[model samples]
Target: MVAPPKPIPAPPPVKRAAALVAILGGALLLLWPAVLNGYPVIFSDTGAFISQTVVPLMIWDKPWIYGPFAWVFHQHVSLWFTIIAHALIVSHMVWLLGRVVGWGSPRRHVALCLALAALTALPWSVSIVMPDVLTPVAILGTALLAWGWPALSRAERAWLLVLTPIAVASHLSNLPVIFAVLVLALLLRAGWGVVMRAAVPLVGAIALLLVTNVVGHGRLSISPYGSTFLLARMIADGPAQRTIAALCPERGWYLCAFVGRLPDDADEFLWNQTSAMNRRPDGTAIFLGGREIAPEAREIVMETLRREPGTVVMLGLGNFLTQMTRSGLGDTTRRRDVGYGVIPHLRNGFPAAEEARFQSALQQRDELNAWALAVARVFPLVLILAAPFALLGWARAHAARDARALGLLLALLVGMTGNALAVGALSGPHPRYQARIAWFLPLAAVVFWRPRPGVIPAAAVPDPARSHTSPG
Candidate 1:
C-alpha cells in the first residue's frame, strides 16, 4: 500500500475560516462599548495626542509617540478608526495568547474575549481614544515573546517583535511594567533564550522613546517631565509638603510661598489655575507649568525621599494597595466637559464635522454615566470573588506541566502589580490606571482553565487524550 500522506500541521481550511470569523467577532465585541456610546471615547489627554499631529508641540507630561500612533489610524478622519484599530490589536493578541496555551480553539478564544469584554474594563479601554488599551497589549505581547516563543509560528514571533515595542513605547509606565515582568520571568527561570528575546522589545521601546525625546524635546531622557509627576505624587501623599516646609525658609524655593495652602490632590496642585504652578496670566496652555519647574520638582522629590523614607514608603504602599483594588471603568466613560482641555484640542485638530460629532456624542452628554458606573461597581466584586478559583486553575495548569501557561500567569501577575506601583506610588492612584490592565487577570484565569472530561466537545479539544500536553 502507498504510504499515507503526512498529516498537515496547520488547521484545515474550514477550521481556519471559522477561526477568522471568531476573531472578527471578538474584535467587534471589544468595540461594542464605543458603539453603545455612539462615538469613540475621548479623555483629556486625547486632545494632546491629536494636537501633536497638527503641530510639533511637545507636551511636557507625555511621550510624542502616541500622537503619531493616533494620526496613523485617524489621519484626521473619524476617531472611530483609532478605536477600531486598538480593538483589532487587542483581539489578535488574545487569539495568539490562546494558541500558545491549550485554549487554541476558536470557540474558546471567542468565549474568553466575550468574558473579558463583559466582566472587565477591557472594552472601555479599547473604546477610548487614549493609549490605555496598549497596557494590556504590551503585557500580552511580553508574555507571548517571553514564554510562548517556542510554540509561536515564525510570523507570529516577527509580528510581536515589531508590535510589542511600539505598544511598550506608547506609554511611559509600560517600560517599568515590562521590565518588572521580564525580571520576574528570569527569576522563575522561564528560559533565558525566550526571556531575553522579550527583552529586545523592552530595550527597543526605551531606545525609541529616548531617540524621540532627543528629536522632539532635544533631550536624551525617556521622560523630561517625570520628576514633575513624581513631585505631584509626593505633594499629594504628604511627604513632599513636610519636606518643602522644612527646607523652604533655608532654601527659598518658589513653592515656599504656599506651605500650608498646598492642594492635597495631585490634579489640584498641578491643574488648578489658582493653585501653585499656575498657567500664565495670558491663559496660555502648559502641562503643570511645563519643564520650567522640572529642576525644582526634581529637587523637591529627592529631598522628600531623603528626609521621610518611612513615611514615603508607607504612603506608596497604601497607594499601591488602593490601585490594586481600584479597577473600574467609570473614568473612561465619564462625561467630557466642553471646557475640558481635550475639547479645544479636538476642535483645533479635527475637522468641523468631526468636532460636531464629538459634541453630540453620548459621552459629551454624560449619558453613559449610569450604566458605566453600575458596571464599574458590580464587576470589581466579581473579580475579587473569582480570584481564588482563578488561582486554583493556575495551580492545576502548573501541575499539568503547562509551563508556558503558568509562566504567562506569573508574568501577568507581576505586570499588574508593577503597573499599580508605577502609577499609584510614582504618580497617584487612579481607577483608569489600574483599569487598563485589569482585564488580563480574567484572561489569565481562562488560560488556566482546562476542559472538563465530557463537558467540552471533541472538536474543541485538538486531542482529547493529550489535552494536558504542554504547548511548548
Candidate 2:
C-alpha cells in the first residue's frame, strides 16, 4: 500500500539564520548613513523635492518623481519610509549579487553581502534622501535583465521591470545610463545570442517622464534646462570666452556686456547667484536668455564648438576624468548658507513636529564631508580596475559559448561610462556625480568574476535549464 509522499520539511535553523542575517544585516548596512546622520539626511534639493508632494509643483533643477514619492511617505507615514524604501532596494541588489555569483550556500551569500556592506560605498546610496542612490541600482538591474534574465524567476522579472523604470525616471541622468545599457544589450542579442526585452523598461521610463512632466511642468519634454546646462558648461570652459571675444559686439548677445565679469569656473557661473549669469538686475541668465531660449544656448554651444572643436573635446575629457576620481558632499552650497536662504521659507511646509529633522546633518556637514572624502579616495582606483578584471575573467572563462559572462562585463562598462558622460558632460565635473555609481564597477566585476581550479566561485546555483543557454 502506497502513501502520498510527505511534503519536504522546512529548512533547518542555521540555514534560516543565514538568510535572516543576509536580509537584516544588509538592510542595516544600507541604512548606516542615516544612522550616522541621526536622521535621513537632506540635500539642498530636499525642500524642492518635497514641494512636489506638498505644493505639487515642478522644479526646474531636479525631477518631480522623487518629490511626490517622498512626500507621500513623509505625510502618510513618516519620512523614515523614504529611507526604508531605499534600503529595501539596496538590499535586493545585495541579494541579486549573491544569486549571480552562485555562492555555494546561504552562509556564503551572507558572507558576500556583509563584505560588500562593509567595504563598498553602497550605504551612501541608500542612506541619502536623493534619487542619486538609485544609479547603481539601475545599472545592476539593467545588467541582470540583459545578462541573467533567463535564469531569473517570473517574480524577479516583474521586479526588474518595476525597478528599472523607477530608476530611469528618478533622474535625467539615469535615462542616458539605462539607454546605453539597453543598446549594449541589443548588441549582445545580435552578436552574442542573448534574449530579453531590453526596451520595455526604457519605454516605460520615457513614458513616465512625459506623463509626470505634463502633470507637474505642463510640458511633454524631458526637461527645459538641457540646453542651458550644456551652454553653462561651455561658457565655463574657454570656448565661450573666445566666442564672446569675437562676436559680442557684432552679435548683440547679452553675455557680451558682462564678459569681463565671468568666472573661470563653470559650476560657479551656473550655481552661484553672484556669477555672470545674473548680469541682468532681474537675476536671469543672460547667456541662457533667462533659460527661456534653450535653443539659443544650444546654438552658442555649437558655435563655440565649431569655432574651437578641441576645447570641447578637452573639456569633456577633463570633466570625465575629474568626476571619476572624487566623491564630496552632496549639497555643500545649501549647508554653507542654511541660515538665510530658501530653507527657512521651505521649512514652513514640513510636517508638524519634523521641522528640526535636518539641522543635525547641517551642523555636521564639514565632518561628514571629510569622512566621505576619506572613504572615497580608494573607490575610484577600485572602479578603475574593475573593467580590466572583467575583461580578464571573460578571457579566462574559456567557455566561448558563454554569452552571459561577456554580456555582464559589457553592461557594467557601458553603464558606468554612460553615467560619467551624462553627468559630467551635461552637468560638468562634480565628484558627487561619479561617486553615486562608481562602486558598481568593482561590484559588477565580482559578479562575473572567474575563479581558478579548486577555488569554487561563490554565487547562486545555476538553473539546469539555463546552464546550456548562451548569455548574449
Candidate 3:
C-alpha cells in the first residue's frame, strides 16, 4: 500500500520584513534635514564629528585624527556611511525582534506591538546621533546569539561570537548591557566554556587596539588619553570648584580668565580645573568621569544627610519623580554652531547667514517650560499603563528553554534601572541624564510586552489530545 502523503514543514517566519520597516524609517530620518532645517537640534558629539572629523576628511587627504575609526573623517563619506550603517543596524534589530516574538505566527500582533513600542516612544533613540542609537541593536543581537546558540549552525554561532565585541565597541553604554548579557548567559546555563568562546573575539579586539596605539603613538594608550589626563586634574580641584564651574557661568568665566592667562593651552587648563574637582583621580576615567562623581559627592553630602537623612532621602525621591515626569523629546538647550568649525566647505551648499539662523533656533528652548512639566507629569502614567503588557512578554520569554530570552529581559531590567539610579544619583537628577536611559526603557517594555486577549502563542500544536500526550 502506498504511504499517506507527508505534511510539508512550514517556512521560517518572514522576520526580514520587520528589518525593512526599520531601514525605511531610518532612511526617512536621514532625509529629515531637508525639511526640518535644524534636524539634529543639539550641538554634541554628533556636531563634534561633523566639525572635527567629517569636514576635515572631505577637505584634506591626511590621516584623520579623531576617534578610533579614521574612516569617518570625511563629511560626505561619513554621512553616506552613517545613513547606510544606521539602516542596516536598525533593520537587523527589527528582523531579529520579529523572529524572537514569532512575527509570522499568531503572535505577530505582539511582535508588531513590540516594534511600535521601540520605534515611536523613544523617537530620539531611533534618529539621533548619540551612542544610545546602538544600544537596542547590540543588546538585541547579544540576546539572540545567547538564545539561539544551540539551534544555530556552527558557522552562524561563530559569526555571532565574532560580532559581539564589535557590537560592544560601537558604544560605551553597550558595555553595561554586554555585562548584563554575560551575567544572564551564565545564569542561563552557559558556563565558562561559552564565556571563553565569546571572549576570544573581545580579547583579540583589545590586543589589536593596544598594538595600534603602541605602533601609532609610541605608547599603549588609545585615543591620545586626552580625557584621562584632564580627569586627573579635575579630581584634585575639589567638588565645590567643579560644581561652581558646572553651574555658574560667572565661575566658568572666572576659570577661563584664570586658565587663559596661564602659559598653557586655555582649553586644557580649563579642563584640568574642571576634572581636578569634579572627577575621580583614577588614572583611567571610565564613562567620561560619571562613575566617580556620585560616590565622592555622596561622601561630601553625608554630613548634610546625617543631619537630615529624611530630607536627603526626599531629595533622592524627588529626583526619581522629576525624571519620570520630564519630556525627553527634542534638543532645546545646546546651541548648534556651524561656523565655529569649517564654514568654507558648506558655504556653497548652505548660506552662512541661514546656517547662523538655524544655529540660533537650535540654541533656543523650542518647548515651553510649562509644556515640559505637563509632559513630564503624564509620562509616568504612560509607563504604568504599558508595564503590565511588557511584564507579560517578559514572562513568556522567561518560560522559554533558551537562556538568551531570560538574559535579554534581565539585562533590560538591570541596565535601565542601573543607569537610571546611577544618572539620577550622580548627576543630581537632571532630565537630560535620565534621557540617556530612554532607549533602554522602551526596549525593556517591548521585551516584556504582552498581546491583548485572543492572540495565540506562536508555536501551538494542532491537536489538543495529542499535545496532552506529548512529553514535557
lDDT of each: 0.77, 0.64, 0.42
Model 3 Cα lDDT, one tens digit per residue, 419-449: 4543343333445444544544555565445
Residue 429 lDDT in candidate 1? 84
Error of 3 at 196 (Å): 4.0
The TM-score measured for candidate 3 stands at: 0.57
Best by TM-score: 1
Who wins the lDDT comparison?
A: 1
Cα-based TM-score, every candidate: 0.89, 0.81, 0.57
Q: Residue 436 of model 1: what lDDT?
A: 91
Q: What's the distance in Å from true for residue 414, model 1?
A: 1.4
Question: Which of the two candidates, 2 or 3, achieves a greater TM-score against the reference?
Answer: 2
Best-to-worst order by lDDT is 1, 2, 3
Predict model 2's lDDT versus the native.
0.64
Cα displacement (Å) at residue 437, model 3 = 4.1
